[model samples]
Target: MPKLQNIIVLRTFAIIAVVLYHCYCPWLEAWNWYKCEYRSLYSFIFETVLVGRMPLFVCVSGYLFSHLYLDRGKYHEFGNFLQNKIKRLLVPCMLFTGLMCLILQLNYVENIVGYGFHLWFLKMLFFCFMTTWLCAKYIHQIKLDIIAICISIIMMFISMPKFLGIGQYFKYYYRRDSRDNGDDAR
Candidate 1:
């Protein structure tokens, strides 16, 4: 599939936003929220990125997927594609996160398994592909392209709030988020 220029531009900005957040976000640590450096500015930037960054990546993914498989009617080849993703994305995700768990010996094994440590995005991508393939394969009544779009929309509706919260949640931590942090944090 040919790359979309707008997607490439969005991806470039998203990468820059992630780098900036990690390097300079005011909430350097999670202990207290209101006492951070750039309370308003960093939170605003971070929230804006949170709202659209990953969704942009997923939208580009859907575009490429439509071009490669759905547009080309390569449904028969989906098995190979899924296997490739398992090898390329899921296998590496498990291996690396498992290694980290082994080395760190953290009690939060669920975290490693559920979220894949620092590889969460890759794991999520793998799941996204799997979900798309499954929906396409089983729900043969609907056209693959339409089904894919519908499913993606549903996913966005369900997932957008969580990602948004991950960005803006810190801003409310001192008041609301902290109340939830009562026992588990210690």
Candidate 2:
């Protein structure tokens, strides 16, 4: 198959944007005369590119998966598909997740459920794809996108993410609190 240069380029830029948003901005601090705050221009950056990139990546991923697998009638090779996902996504996720936990341990970051480590994105991707695959294979009437979206909405309701708001500013896009460790006593 011929490579789609636009998606490849967009994916690269999106990845860079995500990484840059996660890391500190030295130039912004220098401009502020050395007050390294997570606000002003930094907040603008977070609100824009950082907020957009992940969802964009996921959408592109879904599109590519459909184009390659569904278009080619490769769905019958379920064993090969599972093996590929395990090798490509799961193995690296497992390896890096352990390292991330170790780093967090060294830094004394406390949380229950291992806090999913930094590679939680990988785990999320794997679970999402596999869950969709199982749903499609077993329940053959519904559209996959609808199924995925409905499941996500249901999970959100079940999880009650509003009650778990991670950010203090309430106006932020990310309301799910990341620091909660199951201790209401704290």
**Top candidate by lDDT:** 1
Which segments of model 1 are wrong by more than 4 Å?
25-39, 72-75, 102-104, 107-109, 138-186
lDDT score, residue 57, model 2? 64
TM-score for each model: 0.59, 0.65
Overall local distance difference test of candidate 2: 0.52
Worst lDDT run of 10 residues, candidate 1, spans 167-176
Pairing residues by index, what is the TM-score of model 1?
0.59
lDDT of each: 0.53, 0.52
Per-residue lDDT over 66-165 for candidate 1, one digit per residue giving the tens place of the 0 to 100 score = 5666667764567788888889877886678778677768534564445445555566566566666676667774576576566445544342222312
lDDT of 2 by residue, 1-186 (tens): 678798888788777876775554443342222345545777567655465665566656756676676576665567887888778876776676557567645332232123344444554456556655676577665575566556555544343322212211121111233323411111
